[model samples]
Target: MTIGVALIVGDTLRRRWHTDSPGTRGQEFPLLAAREQAARSTAADSTLASQLTLPEKPSIAVLPFQNMSGDPEQDYFADGIVEEITTALSRFPSLFVIARNSSFTYKGKSVDIKQVGRELGVRYVLEGGIRKAANQVRVTAQLIDAATGVHIWADRFEGELADIFRLQDDMSQRAVGAITPMVEHAEIERMKRKPTHRFDAYDFYLKGLASLNLQGSKDAADEALQMFYRAIDLDSGFASAYGNAAFCFVRRLVNAWMEDPKKEIVEAERLATRAVQYGSDDPVALTSGGFTLARLLGELEIGEQHLHRALELSPSYALAWTHRAWIRVFQGRPDEALPDLNRAMRLNPRDPLMPGYFSVMGMAHFVAGRYEEAASWCEKAIQVQPKFLPPLRTAAASYALAGNLQAAQTMMSSLMQLDPRRRISTLRELYPLQRNRDWELLTEGLRRAGLPD
Candidate 1:
């Protein structure tokens, strides 16, 4: 609510640091137990400085750069420049860049570089502030040793706004060039990092990503969607936020959580397009855009390409992985979706939507006509999230398919009691299955389970 003044990448922002309490800061980061093993690994090249040629392989997070330009109109341009730089840094492949959502957690806040390093599981961090005036832009960047709280590299560039692309490429190349070997040597031992904050819009986005892992009740998923919408309202031009929100809507539509899948898909389309238009360069927007198009519109080729480009830009995105997994399941390759789902689960096991992922697995099995397996997975989902909705619908169908009418009816009754707006018309809209096989499988069970819809 308090939109305090804050600086970006380089100049220190004056906003109250989110972690004002030493206790909060201490609770935010745990010691690098994983790094301890790396420290004692007894490197063949004992001197890190001497062996600087060994790719630094540090995973750096580029926090959101503030649009310090006087004109609010220039905000998008500044953001585009920062995104370009982040993309370029991610390209090194040897260097891992934290997902933008995670980095944006520090936006508008005063942060301790060491705390950031520890929280994000990076040995170093690259951050700066952007100030643009007239046609000219100034970007200041610095690399900090998260462990020692020292700046390893710092530089400032003043250039025409039109030349911002050139500046991004140049800065990113130098930064990557500087840390390549150190990152590589340190890569295997690195623990993936994310910010510890939980209340802000940025944190909400991360939680939204985590929600993609849900095993199945609609409760957590609805919660995630609210967060995504909240984030978008907080920053309308925040394309990634919009993109994810749209994608979540599409997921709800596909899984029959909505009363009208057709109408919801239309809304999903609009949100996805808004994301791309607003965040043309943001990997998150691109990825979510692709996912929405693929899942809701069923445009496989273009959607797949967009998703691929997004992954290329931000490979560590757990949501992207889950989206890809969902795409595969729809493509009739249920087996293939498993690995991607597994990866997402591993990345954030405690994600809010974890039950959804488990439910997806269950749905895949049920659709594949493996009723027993579907029931088992649905049970697993129930174990994780007792009130999740998708798994409930899935269980109803799975049990019905297995000829357990009693159990199936029980789930159906629970669903109706929890949400009484059930009717065949509403169910049809919610589960718009174009495929005969999919329609038959889902519809038959629901009908058999005695749901009017």
Candidate 2:
């Protein structure tokens, strides 16, 4: 056997080294040519591998669920479940979720979790099976730590098939809600062991996000801006970095922290423009850029178009929905804004930006002439973030309009302590409400709450 194997290897080497055609002689050895071609292929593969390194944030891939209903027709239903789950997971900006097209390549295959992890460059994999019988459907999903092949979470969902869409939504929501927290916990543990010096542009971006999550802190916003700028310096084409930097200016404007208004507004516009130019498909970039354009630069029409495109790209992106609601409020369409705000809250029930959501809800109600409801929402926002300026101003105005003079006075006192320079005359300049009536209403309530002209 050894001798035969040696003869075969010798013959193979001879064929590879010799050119089959005499005309091709002295041009190149076949084996050397093959090796050169392989070298080029290997270089390309290495580049691809570098591009596929595990993302800085928690990343997950959802494989198509098996259709175990004994009917090939049920395949579509199983695929729908995976699609819904993928869309829901994509709503989370902190997660690096793989799209359905890439994940569906593993459909109907018995895959190795570790292989999926290596190929997809993801930390977690979600796989499951669906069974349908009569008017009912059952889904069994398990989330696995791709590197370790350990099951992190598993759940079974059973629902009526009469409303398949609702079932899909419910299942996806439940799965995502459970999976997100697990992934976050795993990421926290992973970060504890990761060396700080291994930082990349994405690491800087994540650090910026961490600072931004400390809502309503001027110091935190400043730190976040620095981190984002560092990320942009490292990766000049980073759309989200530019978008977030623009949003820091928006935060400054909202909180009256801008020391040089004209210069800051110009910088904000420049950053937002670059974000829109480079991030046509990135919902985070679109949301921040569009909001800044509308709210700060007064480019309402273009801003609304960008925001609409963002929603089309990511229907469940909570931040996009929230900003769209804010734009509606600015457009004097409070009735329309309320629904979008509600949708945003539903999509991200535990969002760190809940204070902003509540404040926007209050603004919508206040603009719609529901003073009591507005005050109620503003109070909720204040309770969550006691120093949040927008809610403080809105609460003061809403309370005064709702005939609660004492509460209005108390809120006005807090607002004054936060921004002693606040004056009724500056309200329109700061807010820039599109409708004269809305501006008049806001100023009147502030005046009644004892703000000076």
Best by TM-score: 2
Superposition TM-score, candidate 2 onto the true structure: 0.59
TM per prediction: 0.54, 0.59
Q: List the residue pairs that clash in candidate 2.
A: none
Q: Model 1, range 135-246, lDDT digits (tens) per residue? A: 6779988888878988889999888755655667667766765776454523222211111112244545544554543424355555555556555545556677778777
Sliding window of 10 residues with minimal summed lDDT for model 1? 18-27
Worst 10 residues of 2 by lDDT: 1-10
Question: Taking the tens digit of each residue's C-alpha lDDT, what string does model 2 give over 7-31?
Answer: 1112212222112211111211112
Displacement of residue 428 (Cα, Å) in model 1 is 4.8
The root-mean-square deviation over C-alpha atoms between each candidate and the true structure, in angstroms, is: 13.5, 23.4
